[model samples]
Target: MPDNATRVLILGHGAMGRAFETLLSARHDVAVWDRDLVTGVETQPLEAAARGREVVMFALPSNPHDELAARLAPCLATNALCVSIAKGLDARGRTPAQVFAQHFGPRRDWAFLYGPMLARELQAGRPGFAMAASLRPSAGARLQALFAGTALHLDCLDDVHGAAWAAILKNVYVPLIGAADGLALGDNLRGFLVAEATRELAGIVEAMGGRADTAYTLAGLGDLVTTATSASSHHRRLGADLATGDATQLAASGANIRSEGVHTVAMVRAHALFAWERFALFALVCDFLDDPARLQAGLDAYLARRFAAPTGR
Candidate 1:
């Protein structure tokens, strides 16, 4: 190994994992472990892959973080930097960082990667950007050093909570954009939805102890634009499916595809984490998700709640 090479163990074999492998393997030693070996990356057991690796990157779904953390906790070497790229809430409404924090003790340091990174674009060596955030000073530096020459440029930021919440909140709002797109509401409506969603995201982030302005950063606005407008976005498709009442669309899309926004919608509703009533647009999306037939009513309610409250709640 070169003096600067970092041993990286990728915990999932999904598209994102392959993207990382393609980018990082150019300069670092990479190994991958996934239950399914569809990707051609070298496979190893959890313990074997994780042990002694300087960095363990998790590219799996949020729901699996708990189990992966359990399996990795025992094997990770001291001072291993744990990185999470998941932008969804786990089953318990904990974010990806929260999941790893549970299992990894002082032996593990933590960081998060977030932004408008599309796996296909990244794997193709197209220019991409992301934020690497950590409270620990060295964690971000290590990531920056590892990806020095890659097409992907990583900026180190200290606002881990803000970046994370923004990323997760964007998933919840993109489906609304998709639903509007499916309904053919025109550019005017799309523009309105984007603005409203961004405002609501900032408000919610602030309510949850994160800086409100962070919503305008790459993790928030940049990611929202990518996911909301992309042709291949599953959350947008789900919104369209809901708007058009087309059940078969999602069925045809495949069962393995999990829409993180679906769970996010449920979580925000059940937990009332941010005084959801203040977020008229979010409330409308949740109502629409619950019953597609209420689409018109949801819109009417959103308009009334938004305009009628100029007095400021």
Candidate 2:
């Protein structure tokens, strides 16, 4: 390995993991491990792969973070930095960053990498942008060095919580965009949904103790545009399915859709994480998801309330 090249272990062999491998293998000593074995891929045991690594990237879903972090806590180098690319809350409604904080605390440095990084584009050697947010400045610096001169560009920020929340929250609106498209509501409504979602996202971020402006950054608006507009985006497709009343069609097609936004919608509603009543757009999406039959009526009601004429006192 080159002197500047870092030893990086990527947990999970999913699309994002492969994308990261494509972005870094030529420049760094990269090793990948997944819970399930993949045919013809060289991989060592978890402990062996993690040992002596300078950085460990948790490219898995947020749900498995707690278990993985605990298992790897003793195997990592003392100064290794852990980064998560997950954009959803875990089963307990805890972000991956929060799970890392619980397991690693101040002893092990951790960070979140989030933005408009679609796995397919990155795997195709296209450029991707993300914010590397960590409470510790050194963690972000190390992450930047690891991906230097690669297709993945990293901008460092100190607002780890803000970036994490922004990334997760943006997915919540993707289905709404897709629903509009599915309903054949035209580009005008699509644009309106994006703007309204961003406004609600900013407020939710602030309510959750993150910077409101973070909602407009790469982690928020940038990702929202990418996921909401991309034809292959699962959450967007879920919205379209709901709008068309064919929510089961995607599953029948064997697309392996994770649809993180679906889980987020349930988590947010069950936990009352935000003032749902104040977010008409989000509430509308949730109502559609909860009962697809109401989609048309809900959309009509939402627009009616949004555009109602003001009555003079």
Candidate 3:
């Protein structure tokens, strides 16, 4: 390690964790620990690994964030920054920021990294982009230092809540693109959905106490395009499966498929997070998930409503 290397601990050794390790290990002293250990790698206990670390990254899904945050809170260094890349909501409909704030409070330094960061591309040493938002003003600079000399690039922003919601909401919209492609609706519809999704996303983010423009940032529009079109994206594949009437795959347990959007749909609806009537596109997605048989008609009706003329004129 370089003389100026920072100590970093990455929680969760999944693909994203390993990708981050690959990105940062060359310049930083890095340690990784997962709940389940791989066969041939040496690892340390979570608490031990966290001590003295300047940055601790949670690369796991949002569902496990609560437990992990609670466990690692006491072990983290006083000024250490906690970064979460989770792009979904927890069972309680809380974003990663909500979970972190619950455990770390305002005093602790924490940040959210969100964007079009595909693990496969990052692992392959291809360039990736993300936005870093944190309560601490310097958190972005700290993250930039941590990943210096790597292909991953970071843009700093102050709208942490907006960025987080943008990231989460993008995943929810990706399925619509996949479903359109799966139905052979062509590129015209795909383009339309992308435009409408971005608009609706801005409104929803604003309503959720985030800046509307943040929806156009890397965390929202950038990530949405990547996840929507990527062949390897789980949510995209879920939409395709839904289009093909693959009930077996659609009904598979979350453990088997790991589609965050599916769980997001449930959480949003259950919590009544937004005014559903205002977001017709999102509401249509929720309706599709509830009854896949209505997809074709739903799309037709949605398009009709969009193209409908001014009433009574």
Candidate 4:
């Protein structure tokens, strides 16, 4: 509508996609696409949505990324910026960036949006910050500039791999805090979970050829805190349900709900991208997830070995 407005094509009709449309439509020419006929916003055919848009924002989960990316590759305007909000690994253990790169190649500019952003809070106009990671040094700053007047404050990151991995791994770790909460382990253990999870995340990130320190940034630590502590967080609630060992309770939480962390645990275990055993805290969570009966014994063994390992030997 406005002369300076950038054309934005949003994929998916989910909450995150709708939120982005709600926030940016008034200012920018926005079009949304979904497989089904969606309400609340006008839906466009895939080709029409991708045509001439300056930026294509994917609001779907990671599972659909590769397919949708392949479909949209030929439709996208040359050099259009592609943004991913998915925070988990695909079936091939590929990050969103990797999926898009495989499909879009050098035809599109790529960026990942990650941090403590909940679509509901964002739609309600709550102030929030996120990291925009890109391999191109100017991509982050350019993205930051795009939201210059918005409530969403964005910081750019050059370590795209580090930021992406940090964001992904935080989801895997957040549920541990929730399980601790379900067990009523108190703030003391909560503090330990935070410290140990961050440390383990850094090690995994480094092993995967990413900057280990990125784990301390907003994409990693900031998001971990939000997902771990928030009562509204599905992953947190899932953890609490897991701790109770009630299959019906877990089932009642809904099969359709996207718990990125659940899939991430399996991916980490299957991929062997890192020395997963070295990160005892992460391994503890994985072992517990794989066999809930091991929650108590696994935790005890982890703590015992951690404390008893002789220092300065």
Candidate 5:
């Protein structure tokens, strides 16, 4: 982080990528690279951006991380660190860091970055903190300080695995709760929903080897609150629309930002990886999205559970 001359190639010029380029530009040599980089970013090609860059941060859509990792693996500088900003799970049920490690290949160090960093806020130069981690400490720090600017605070963790796992576990819970808001539940019920769902998040994170304390930190719980409640989130809006019925029309109306929790919920069910205690309802939530009667049944169960075991499912 102490160095200023490092060239940084930010992959995927989406909202988060642009925000990062703007935030880190003054502190380092920064440029964006996406599939549509030349057009979407109004810039040069990614291969061109990689020239002399010491670090490459992968901010692509969650689904294509592995593809990009494999594509960019050969071109990356031997010493460059490939950082991941994606918070969703991959096809192999791996976190972004795992995908990079397996697919990013020989040249660069693979790492992950995670937090409650809202792209809109970061684009505005709002003060925000994020974490960077990799199995290799020194290699991880190459891009760590690139984001350690005054407006963008940074923390260094050695465990990218735990950090990424916690991030997605929390992200996986946000939208379902947002759908509850559309269910027209009163504040009391919403409060219980958040508390229980987050407890589920914390449990899953710990089960996956993250600190239980991490869930209370800005990266996990804070991210859940923001993604679940913010009017700006496509995920929340998607849930609101789903609750109102007519999901196909809602998708057509919404912005291009993918509904991360929607995809995550499907994958979550396929993996059956988490403790269903407080989160068993989410299993129903997945199916209920397609059936109105089942959706109503979920609400009824929420009420039933509310009085039965406040401790958890």
Candidate 6:
């Protein structure tokens, strides 16, 4: 327990961690750690780092998140509030809140942040926004205050599972969007892709016990645009690079912080169109990345599925 400092321990310093540090370091004490480093930051062991922190944000990629979080569980101070900035599918098959509760026990607090805010832009104080939920939703206020009227629009959301599910599902269509662009598709095609994907996800989440509003909020539309269309997105880049037959480069892009969606494509739990969304995306991504010869047909068929009458929509 250090004196005269509000310790903020940030795990996963890639984009979001640095965004927090770059923005909040001037007013708060911060330390960062990541399992693998794309760029270096002064970091401490998770247990050691958690020893006396007032706040701990888990900004990890979704892969192996459960294992890593379990390892981090005992290290946190009993009162430290945990926040997660992860917005991809869980390779570990656990919810972000579940991971936190397992680690810190019921006495501690936790939160999840999902939105369109890209780590790179957020770090530089660019315009950004996010939806958040916490056991102590007010705990989000501290962070919201830190971002205040800045480009980062911070709002409180009460639905945890729905928000998380929407966040994970949005990753599915971003690659499809990339596939669309790779094959010389227009905005009309991209828009059609997003609309169809949203309807499918909205229905699935509602059936799975989530709210329809989940699909229209910051986590859904916001994240889809950034990830699906942004040139800087690793997932979007993966699709385009693979389309160009640059498997080596595409593979290299994910080496540091691998996109969890790419890996989780094999295990998506939701159904999309006539088949499982996960399965359809997995096949398309594999072809776009592994066998470019089939990119055109895959992209076209996937798009057609979306805009094709919509089953009487």
Report the lDDT tens digits of candidate 1 across residue range 1-313: 5777898988787899999999988688898888753563445567876877989998877777898789877777777888988887766778776676678743467888888889999998798888887767788898888889898888887777788889988988887788878888788888888888888889888888788988888888888988899898888888888888886654554323347776777777676656777677777877887787788778767767667845656
Which regions in candidate 3 have their CA more than 4 angstroms from the true location?
37-44, 253-257
Sort the predicted structures by TM-score, highest score first. Answer: 3, 2, 4, 1, 5, 6
Where does model 4 exceed 4 Å of error? 37-43, 249-257, 309-313
* Pairwise lDDT winner, candidates 2 and 5: 2
Native-referenced Cα lDDT, model 6: 0.68
RMSD of 4: 2.8
Winner on lDDT between 4 and 6 is 4
lDDT of 2 by residue, 11-118 (tens): 988899999999899989998887753363445677878889988998888877888898888878789999999988877888888888888888778999999889
**How do the residues 1-313 of candidate 4 rate in per-residue lDDT, one tens digit apiece?**
7788988888887888888887787788888887763453435567776889888888877877887888888877677888988888888888887787688775457898888888888889987679998887666776786676766789888788888899988988777788888889789988888988998898888888889888988899999988898889988877777887854545563323346787787776788667778788888888877777677788788779878957785
If the candidates were sorted by their lDDT against the true structure, best first, what order would they fall in? Answer: 3, 2, 4, 1, 5, 6
Name the lDDT value of residue 8 in candidate 1. 92
Q: Compared with the true structure, what per-residue lDDT tens digits does model 5 show for residues 1-313? A: 4354678888777788888888877777777776653355425655666767788877775667777777666777677777877877766567777787777643457777677678888888787666766677776566555665546666777666677776776655655666677777666766776777667666666777777666666567667777777778777666666777748734574322355565566566678656544456555556555564466677787678667855756
After the best TM-score superposition of candidate 6, give how far the Cα of residue 248 lies from its true spot, in angstroms.
Answer: 2.6
Residue 304 lDDT in candidate 4:
90
Summing lDDT over every window of 10 consecutive residues in candidate 3, give the lowest-scoring window: 36-45
Candidate 3 per-residue C-alpha lDDT over 1-313 given as tens digits, one digit per residue, 9 for 90 to 100: 7999988889888899999999999889988877753363436667777889889999988988998899889888789899999988888889998899899988888999999888999999899999998877788999988887898999998899899999988878887789889989899989999999999999999999999999999999999999888889888878878887885656775722257887887888889988866799998998888887798999999989999988894
Pairs with steric clashes in candidate 6? 127-151, 128-151, 128-152, 128-153, 272-277
- Cα deviation at 153, candidate 4, in Å, is 0.7
Taking all chains together, the TM-score of candidate 4 against the true structure is 0.92
Cα misplacement distance, residue 102 of candidate 3 (Å): 1.7
| Model 5 weakest 10-residue run by lDDT | 249-258
RMSD values, in order shown: 3.2, 2.6, 2.3, 2.8, 4.0, 4.5
Task: Quote model 5's TM-score.
Answer: 0.83
Candidate achieving higher TM-score, 1 or 2: 2
Residue-pair clashes per prediction, in order, are 0, 0, 0, 0, 1, 5
lDDT of 4: 0.81
Q: Which candidate achieves the best lDDT against the true structure?
A: 3
